[model samples]
Every structure is written in C-alpha cells, then in structure tokens.
Target: MTICKGVLNSNVLFYKKLKMEVDMRDQILEILTEQRPDVDFNSETSLVTNGILESFDIVSIVAELDDTFDIEISPKELVAENFDSLDAIEAMVERLSEEE
Candidate 1:
C-alpha cells in the first residue's frame, strides 16, 4: 500500500531516521574502537572523567569525527559531556549535521 505523508508515512520516516542514527552510532563505535581497542566503549562512560581519553586522543577523535561526518566540531563544543560517551558523541554529530 502507498502511504503519503500521513501517519504511516510518518512512522516510516521515523524508522528510516532511526536506522540512519544507528548506522552513525556504529560508525562512531568503529572509530572509537580503532583508537582504543582495549577500551570497552559499549559500557564505559567515564572515558573523559576517568582520564581514559587524553588530549591527544581527543584530537584524534575530533579529526576522525570531522573526516567521517564532514562536520566541523568547534573548540567550544569540545566539552567533557560531549565526549563522555558514544551516545553523547553521536548526538553531537547528529546535531551538528542538522545544523549543516
């Protein structure tokens, strides 16, 4: 059945957006794992708080994020909360992408 921009279409769009977000999350996971294979990104949320992520690591992450998503992460956006977890990073990327 063909669904216009009605309820069913809205649900379809929602699911498509959800799948895109999940794909973005997985890409971010891959990048983080490449940076620190020993770290458990799935469960570890104190990467910045626990000093698991150093300045150099942040630089590398920023570069990778910029390259992967084609979005610029400004200096002001580089806060502990933004890089605290994979979810946070993914949200930031989605927000920035929306801005662009």
Candidate 2:
C-alpha cells in the first residue's frame, strides 16, 4: 500500500509539471503570435536565422516575455539561438523561471 501510494504521488507530481510546461508553452505562443501576426511561429523553427524576426521584434518579445513571465532576461541571454524557435523560447522561459 505504501509503495503504491508513493507511485501515485509521483505520477501526480509528474502530471502537474507536464501541465505547467504545456501552459507555459501556450502562453509563449500567444505572446509570439500577438507580436507577429503574419509569421507562423509554430511552423518556423529558424526565426532568427531565417530573418523571420527582426531586431525590433526581438526587443518587443523580450519586453513582453519579461512582463508576462516576471523573469529578467539579461543581455547575456539575448542570443539568436534562444529566440530561434518556439521551443527555444519556451525552454529559455522555463530556465529563467526556475532560476527565480
């Protein structure tokens, strides 16, 4: 009984974490879509390399992400790779949130 309960608890925790990640991704996607309505963020993986997102767009995204996520994106993290894809942006936000 004790072992089963422990397993159940772990499963619950895992589900919660997974749900949080999904929610965070959705929020990031919403922000990105709002910033650039013409671009399809889901399909494009090379947002920076392909010149899909310009410098001003990055600036706006950084500001919105900072305000929305309550995470301070320092100058060091302002790299092309971090903003290259939806997954990259989501990963960066998760890392920053964990640091805080």
Candidate 3:
C-alpha cells in the first residue's frame, strides 16, 4: 500500500511539472508573438539559423524571459542552443530556476 501511494504521488508530481512546463511555453510564445506578430513561431524551429531572430531580438527575448520568470540569465547562458526554439528557451529557464 505504501509503495502504491508513493507511485501515485510521483505521478501527480510529474503531471504537475508537465503542466507547468506547458504553461511556461505558452507564456513564452505569447511574448514572442507580441514581439513579431507576422512570424509563425510554431513552425519556425530555425529562429537563429534562418535569421528569423537577430541579435537585438534575442536580447529582447532574454529581457522578457528574465522579467517574466523572475530569474536572472547569466551571460554564459546566452547561447544559440539555449534560445534556438521555444523548447530550448523553456529548458534554459527551467534550468536557471532550478539553480536558484
């Protein structure tokens, strides 16, 4: 019975974390859309590679994410991989939040 309870609790935590991640992604997409409404963020995975987002856009995104998430992104964390796609940005935010 104790083992079953533990498993159930773990599942609950997992789902909660998943939901949080989805919410974070949505919030990020909102910010991105507001920045560039014409661009299709959902389909554009090559934001940096394809020149969809330039250096200034990246700086703006970093500021928005920093303010929204209440976490400070270090200078070293400002890499292409961290801001390549919505998932990558979310992962970076989550990692920074964990560190804090």
Candidate 4:
C-alpha cells in the first residue's frame, strides 16, 4: 500500500508538471502570435536566423514576456539561440522561472 501510494503521488506530480509546461507553451505562443500576426510561430524553427523576427520585434517580445511571466530577461539571456523557436522560448522561460 505504501509503494502504491508513492507511485500514485509521483504520477500526479508528473501530470501537474506536464500541464504547467503546456500552459507555459500556450502563453508563449500567444505572445509570439501577438507580436507577429503574419508569421506562423509553430512552423518556424529558425526565427532569428531566417530573419522572421527583427530587432524591434524582439524588444517588444522581451518586454511582453517579462511583464506577463514576471521574469527578468537580462542582457546575457538575450541571444538568438534562445529566441530561435517556440520550443526554445518556452525552454528559456521555464529555466528562468525555475531560477526565480
């Protein structure tokens, strides 16, 4: 009975974490879509390298993300690789959120 309860608790925690990640990704996608309505963020992998998002766009996104997510994106965190894809942005946000 003790082992079963532990396994159940672990599963619940895993589900909660998975749900949080999905929610975070959805929020990030909304932010990205608001910044650029024309671009399809889901399909694009090379957001920076392909020149899909300009400098001003990045600035706006950074501000919005900071305000919405309550995460301070320092200068060092501002890199092309971090903003290159939806997954990258989601991963960055998760990392920052964990740090705080």
TM-score of each: 0.90, 0.96, 0.87, 0.96
lDDT, candidate 1, 1-100, per-residue tens: 5645487889989999999988999999999999989899999887898999887898899999999999999999988899889888888999999998
Q: Could you tell me the TM-score of candidate 4?
A: 0.96
What is each predicted model's overall lDDT from 0 to 1?
Answer: 0.91, 0.94, 0.87, 0.93
- The weakest ten consecutive residues by lDDT in model 2 span 72-81
- The regions of model 1 sitting more than 4 angstroms off are 1-5
- Please report the TM-score between candidate 2 and the true structure: 0.96
Largest lDDT belongs to which candidate?
2
Ranking by lDDT: 2, 4, 1, 3
**Candidate 2 pairs with clashing backbones:** none
Clashes in model 4: which pairs?
none
lDDT of 2 by residue, 14-100 (tens): 999999999999999999999999999999999999999998999999999999999999989888899999999999999999999
> Tens-digit lDDT track for model 4 on 1-100?
9999999999999999999989989999999999999999999999998999988999999999999899999988888899999989999998999898
Report, for all candidates in order, the number of backbone clashes: 0, 0, 0, 0
